[model samples]
Target: MTDHGPQPVERQLPTEEARDLLALVRDLVQREIEPGAAEEEEAGRFPREVFRLLSASGLLALPYTEEFGGGDQPYEVYLQVLEELAAARLTVGLGVSVHTLACHALAGYGTKEQQAEHLPAMLGGGLLGAYCLSEPSSGSDAASLRTRATRDGDTWTIEGTKAWITHGGIADFYTVMARTGGEGAHGITAFLVPGDAPGLSAAPPERKMGMKGSPTAQLHFDGVQVPDARRIGDEGQGFAIALSALDSGRLGIAACAIGVAQAALDEAIAFTAGRRQFGRPIADFQGLRFMLADMATQIEAGRALYLAAARLRDAGLPFSKQAAMAKLFCTDAAMRVTVDAVQLLGGYGYTADFPAERYMREAKVLQIVEGTNQIQRMVIARHLAGAESR
Candidate 1:
């Protein structure tokens, strides 16, 4: 783990509007988000009402431009909103994050006409979006994706299946990456396809280990039709677009990891302080106290990593390496802290009586998504190697 001495807490210089936006998010999360987390997760139910609630609060479009009926919030401010939402409910946070990434492909790289056509519906219409980049044979090595899109007059027909899409069948639109040219990364292109287009279908969700409330399914595009105007950026720019979207999305996942870790830590601390053992509260023990300290330390560190990455994005600097570092570090820390929280609670932690069990399960997926921690290491090492590749 990248260790540094206990750093001072970060204080961001947000404008007044940004501060108010964050406060609004915090209030909404505490009031409406956390209360239903357990019930929704247990039932494997999507919280559609929660999405409407967030959209009404103006958070669903925080990352987009003001012209699109969005908040036009800075990346730094937007990530803080994600952190608060995630701290309340990870499923909802992930859904929002994925939608934001899907939107990124259009908002960041699309033509002005493309933006005018889709940004309003995507940003403020109370609808969800999905990114279709991964395939059955392509996860970490996303450039190997085999989904194809072929030109047919003024239209393009997309074929093949996308694996592990977050919104899957529920989204109104999808930002899909498919091979349009020869091979490797440079051949890929991104398209904006309506979810209800002919020949579009999604398989039933995969039985996941966690994030039960968020759907995950394979998106099948069997001759699905998309207009030429729906394409994002020029041909061969899709791979670069996908990678850039991931660089931002990684920060989102890292914020989520810290949220889950914080939730687990809170539960652990509360339980240890109240549960009596050997005629005293278990928290009275120095060993347990040290463990709690470590958990808190991990939470703060994870927060720092993602916030640092967000600050870089806000400053218009290169943050890809730092974003990967945040995702890798924070997810690993969440796994460690949540597992220990379970250990601290003994058998009770293993059971559903406490949220730590759920927290532990949630932490595992963060390591795997937005590129695996293994991929993160490769990304970091590649940055270190630069042009010196053997």
Candidate 2:
């Protein structure tokens, strides 16, 4: 099951159990999340009830092990679930991806005791999670972070500001990265900082271009105390943990991008077919039909890229390059497809009359977050050169 590039195969759909799960998820997403999504975005409200619905349905923990009250699905399957959620609402999909990324360090790298204590609550609780890696001055260069973490006997004292923290004020736990050594990537380390920890607080949410329903705030750790046991791995392993987690996180975002594109395409198809203009259905026009075909083609290619990367991950291979490729290609594809979708709808698309406007706004953030597309290209270039040299 190795894929060399973006050629998608028409393989069999999901099996019985997987299909049933997908159907259940599709229904839940459409019924529970889609209806209020626009209103929520307009009102700048988080979907607490929808989060509870997903948590209860086991979608929140879909990729985790079943041993700790999770759905125990593979990335290939879990990504589709995310795609469905994103199609319904971009905020829910991004929130889920951020939370899952937050859990990666603890679940995969934590000691058995740590996993036993923290994963269950994170996988299936009312509590949310946030990955605290990006800082005010250090985003793309994550290793250059300045947050200080000094060892204080059995506990660690952490003091720093974590910027662009999703679920910043609302999450139950934050996977925080701080400078534990000297200047450079090696000095950084990851620590599980509880939201309720003393000396820890969040600033008010930042006004953003989009994804308003998903809050983003800066977190302040003023002499925050952490147990030595909360460190994800050895002192310098924080970068490794964060990178590994993002390898999976990028795939999640790619899937969400596909969903965004799919949603836009679906809206376009419906709009064009029903929208009568010049005494004929707009979809009947050859020019408009060509654009629709291109949108669908790009989406199919994006799915193939992510799925190939997912298979590589499931097979325990080096997939950083593939992950980056998927994120970069799919996100850019979403941006183009969604914008064209809006263009196809004309005046209605510009206003709130269609979902394509929101879809376009949501598409912009995907390119910026989870390592900018520029960052993705750098990663891919390194991997390509590294491979060619080898």
Candidate 3:
């Protein structure tokens, strides 16, 4: 099987261990994931086995504390791993990101007892997880979510639907946010709901334009019962926890965007180099050459932006604004780069015969997920404008 694909990226990892880890990832991607990405994606099949392999190899829990089955790798290192996985297949990369987001509330805010009880299996025990924050009416305005949780003695009953959930039906656990008090952000609370709870169910997955292999569906909680022990963070602190998770998850989205852009650029480069036009390879044409150069430049810039944000996070510095910026720029760059890739390939790019069209389709959703690029600009602008008057 000839992999007429992109060359491996030359990454500047911070440590020899990180370098080794990336090398292992690259090898696995080339041999296992990349080969079947197009075929499976075309069939709209989720690669559950690949996820299992990632979990078994400790690749799934790279950024959390090692005390609870995680690799304790820095955010910088973890983001790069996401980039590599996304370059092979966006489903794998984004899936890992959402899983990490799902674990954030418990890992960062759960009591020691909760962490001791659940962190190990959630981190590395091959269990997949989902984060539920968005509802049908409240995506950008997340604080307006309508999911409700009511306490009954020591137990809580969750009701309402979570929309656009990744891994909706298949996840073993879900980190859910439900209104528990007044009618605003301060009212919401987080809970870890087991997938098989009696009244918990998933609607059919959405018919999406790209990344169809990744399940995106609506989850319903019909009076699902949860113990108080499953609650994450103090009551009324779920919105803050959700925002904190998004800050890190935005970096993951940025990395995934760059990876997809890089992959598209690589495919365009490979195709043009061997393709003949006017008695020579098209790569010799100055017009086409400039387009390739611009694509490469955008990918590099996006990678640098995301890495800078990741490093800030690793240093425990304030990085929310930078994270928003990275997500905005990288996803926009991916959309542009993938479109250029399609144009460079001419008619072939328009068809499913090549991956350029798929890349183009995949790049679009990046702008909309995690947070919309428009929402990202608002976030950045708020940081610049100082705190709101309220």
Error of 3 at 217 (Å): 0.4
| Top-lDDT structure, candidate number | 3
Q: After superposition, how far is residue 95 of candidate 2 from its true place, in Å?
A: 0.9
For candidate 2, lDDT tens digit of each residue in 189-304?
88998889999999999999889999999999999999999998999889888999999999999999998888888888888888899999999999999999999999999999
lDDT of 3 by residue, 21-58 (tens): 99999999998899989999999999999999999999
Query: Highest TM-score, which number?
Result: 3
TM-score of 1: 0.95
Q: List, residue by residue over 1-390, the lDDT tens digit for candidate 1.
A: 111111222446479887777667766776777776877898999988888777776778987889977777887888777777776789988888998998999999999988988888788888788999999999988989999999988888899999999989999899999999988999999999898899999999999998899999998899998989998999889999999999999999998888788778878887887889999999999999999999999888888889888888988999999999999999999999999999998888899867888889998999999899999999999988995871
Taking all chains together, each candidate's TM-score versus the true structure is: 0.95, 0.95, 0.99
**Candidate 3 at residue 238, lDDT?**
96
Task: Please give the clash total of every predicted structure, in order.
Answer: 0, 0, 0
Query: Which pairs clash in the backbone of model 1?
Result: none
Report the C-alpha displacement of residue 377, candidate 2, in angstroms: 0.4
